[model samples]
Target chain A: MKRYAPYIIVVLLALLPFSGLSTYMMHIIILMIMWSVIGMAWNLLGGYCGQVSFGHAAFFGVGAYTAGILYFKLGISAWWGIPLSVVVLALEALVIGFICLRLRGPFFALATLAMGEVLRVTAENLRDFTQGTLGILIKERTWVEKTWYYYIILAIAVLTYIVVKKIIESKLGYYFVAIREDQDAAESLGINTTLYKTIALVISAVLTGLAGAFYTNYMGYIDPEVVFALHDISIITIMIVMVGGVATYWGPVVGAGIMVVLAEWIRSLPRIGTAHQTLFGVLLILIIIFLPNGVVGDFSKIKRALGFGRKV
Target chain B: MTPLLEIKRVSRFFGGLAAVMDVSFNVNKGEIVGLIGPNGAGKTTLFNVINGFYKPSRGDILFKGQRISGLKPHRICRLGIARTFQVVKPLQRMTVLDNVVASAFLRSDSKREAVKKAEEILEFTGLSSEKDKISKGLPLGMRKRLEIARALATEPELLLLDESFAGLNPTELVQSIEVIKKIKERGITILIIEHHMKVIMSISDRVVVLNYGEKIAEGTPEEVSRDPLVIEAYLGEAPAA
Candidate 1:
């Protein structure tokens, strides 16, 4: 019964578009799925591998640009960016991992944050290549309806979910956890910490790049600031994973759903729309204080607090 | 038979201080050689160098006649040398079985095979009863046993036990001695760093004593225990007539 939950949810979501939902509702769903993809990717590296990144926006933006540039320069369809960005993002992941993976803990996080900022600045400066700060515009979008985009991202999310799940259940997954728990111990026990860490980073970056490519095709436009926004792309990716659950499989999905809905609801307010970020900040603070391990991670505590189960 | 491990004048320095200075020793195949020293006498530092955690500032380490000094820890581990930590470093969130299974994966390609091997190791280490328990929740004695279980899962030819008996109670100490004996019976060479004189004196076929980063004495456990230099190092005074 528990095994079928994800498939059941996917089936229901697949049928959701035919339920006469508004365009706005479909857009929110798409955003939710997309955020979850990014969240899951981040979880692989940060939660499991213990290499928390604060610069996922770099991969996200690089992926976005890979598609955007191919469209703007070569006049090819941006959809090709989805497949092409894998190679691009992998090289990016390797270079970044080589430089940033040497630093541990918060220093690694800060280094990634700086890497994201550097990419953002680089995208803005390279006018001939990235169209400068004006960003790349996809004049002709592939889809007129949100339904197709919704299905596309849902497919990507499902793939991400399966891949992440398989890896976590394998021996590679054990190595990641071992490295996270104690690197020296992992090494002494014959696990190559650096190699496993790089594998995690590469897988994570490539998945995020896929989502970025999808965003390029769906949104029809992307500026460096929009795609590479520190708080929005990178930190929010962390937040989704954190709010969902750190290492649990379902954490990011639940986190993305709540965060996307909350963001949409807060932004829909007339006078308070601009203050949505402030609301998010408060909510994040409360979640951290109350559920440091996120919702799924602290499910027992939440159940107890709500008086849902039999007493111990 | 060639020695399983040979350390020739190994020295590890931190800044200007020599933590392990010009220390040399060897462990013959299938022998349980005890490394005994007072605190700050560089026993752990020497273990670190032997296991490739620290590169020796001078001298060479030979495992099966191959120079292994300065090799990465994992590479050294793959070359059949495995060591436990002085402070136990069990993968805290993982179960004892999972911890050993993770190490078992080093040799076995199949997860099922690794798991089967890990269970056998756990049984050997007498940790089969607590296999499902998270390592962090284990008592100090069990945690040390888990450490040995983990290292043994790597199928090492040379097992280096760093202070494996540090905090064990008398019963636990006896159990550990039996476990170590069983490990030696499997034909794996054992080099152990221990402080408890009685424990080391009982199980060790030979004992090497270090003082102030140097090999002060080396002989049978009985001989080294009665050595004048070892007595002075441990007691900070000459032995009474």
Candidate 2:
């Protein structure tokens, strides 16, 4: 049953569009799927490999810009950006890993955060290339309806899920966990900690880049502030994994669902809509305090707390 | 035949201090060589240099007649040298089986092969029952055994044991000695650092004694125990005798 669960979920999601939901609801679902991809990507480096990144926006923004520029400057369909971002993001991840991976723990996180900000500023200043703060606008979206967009993102999410699962369950996964647990010991055992860490970074960066490319085509407008956003792109990526589970495979997906829904619902509330972020912050704090391992990680604790499955 | 590992005029310096200076020895194939010293006699530092944790300040380390002095730790491990830390470093979050499996990957790329090898090693180390348990909460003796199990998974030709018997109770110490003997029976060379004189005298094929940063004596356990320098290093000088 557990082995077949992913396929069942995918089939159910594939049938969701036929239920005839409103356009607004479709948008929310698309956002949820997209967030899940980003969350999974982040989890590879942060959770499994134990290299938490604060500059994931750099990859996200670079991926978004890859699509944007191909359309704006190259006079090509922005959809081409999806395939092209793989090559671009791999190189970008390599460069970022080289600079950031030398530092350990929080230093690595801070370095990544700075890398994200640096890229944002670079995108802003490259007026002719990136249009500076003026941003890139896709005058005509590819599809008239949200269904195609939903299917496309759904496919990407599925691919991301499968890839993350395969890597985590394989020999590479053990190497990653070993590196996370004790780098020195990993090295002693002939693991080559630096090389494995870079591999994790590259895969993670490339996945996030794919989502960023999808964002450009779906949203039709992007600026340095929008795609290269630190709080919006990077921090949200971390929060999703934190709220879901750190190293567990299902953590990021569950986290994304909760985060996307909570963000939308909180923003939709009247009178308090502007304070949605504040309310979200409080909720995140509470979750951290009560469930440091996130929802799926602390599910047993939650069951106990709620008085379910008690022998008494 | 050439020694399996050769340490010739090796030294390591920390600023003005010499942690290990001009210390040299050889471990021939399939010998359980014990390295004994008082506190801070560069025993652990020598292990670090031999395994490529720290490059020797002076001299060379040759493994199987090839220069291995400046290579990285992982590179050396790939060349069939594996070492356990004095302070055991286990993969704290992973199950005992998983921890060994990670090291087993050094010999085989297949996860199944690694797992099979890990299980075999767990059984050999007497850790099969606790293989499902996470390593973080393991008792000291079990953790020490897990360290050896993990290193053994790499299938090293030369195994460096840094105080493997340290901190174990009587039962664990005896069990550990049996494990070491069994490891030797497999024809792997062992270089062990041990503080317990009785265990060292009982199991070691030969012993090397160190004092302050230099090799003081090297011989059979009986000969080394009887050496004046070795005795003085451990028990200090006799005023009138």
Strongest candidate by lDDT: 2
Q: What DockQ does each prediction reach against the true complex?
A: 0.90, 0.91
Model 1, runs deviating above 4 Å: B239-241
**Candidate 1: tens digits of C-alpha lDDT, residues B91-171:** 999999999999999999899999999999999999999999989999999999899999999999999999999989999
Q: What's model 1's lDDT at A172?
A: 94
lDDT of 1 at A258: 91
Candidate 1, residue B236: Cα displacement in angstroms equals: 1.2
lDDT of 2 by residue, B1-241 (tens): 9999999999999998898999888999999999999999999999999989899999999999999999999999999999999999999999999999999988886999999999999999899999999999999999999999999999999999999999999999989999999999999999999998899999999999988889999999999988999889888898796
Candidate 2: which pairs clash?
none
The residue-by-residue lDDT of candidate 1 on A87-202, one tens digit each, is 99999999999999988899999999999999999999999999989999999978788999999999999999999999998999999999999999999999988899999999
Query: Model 1's lDDT to the true fold?
Result: 0.94
Quickly count the clashes in candidate 1.
0
What's the residue-level lDDT of A118 in candidate 1?
Answer: 97
Q: Each model's C-alpha lDDT?
A: 0.94, 0.94
What overall lDDT, based on C-alpha atoms, would model 2 receive against the true structure? 0.94
Predicted candidate 2 versus true structure: per-residue lDDT over A208-250, tens digit per residue: 9999999999999999999999988999899999999899888
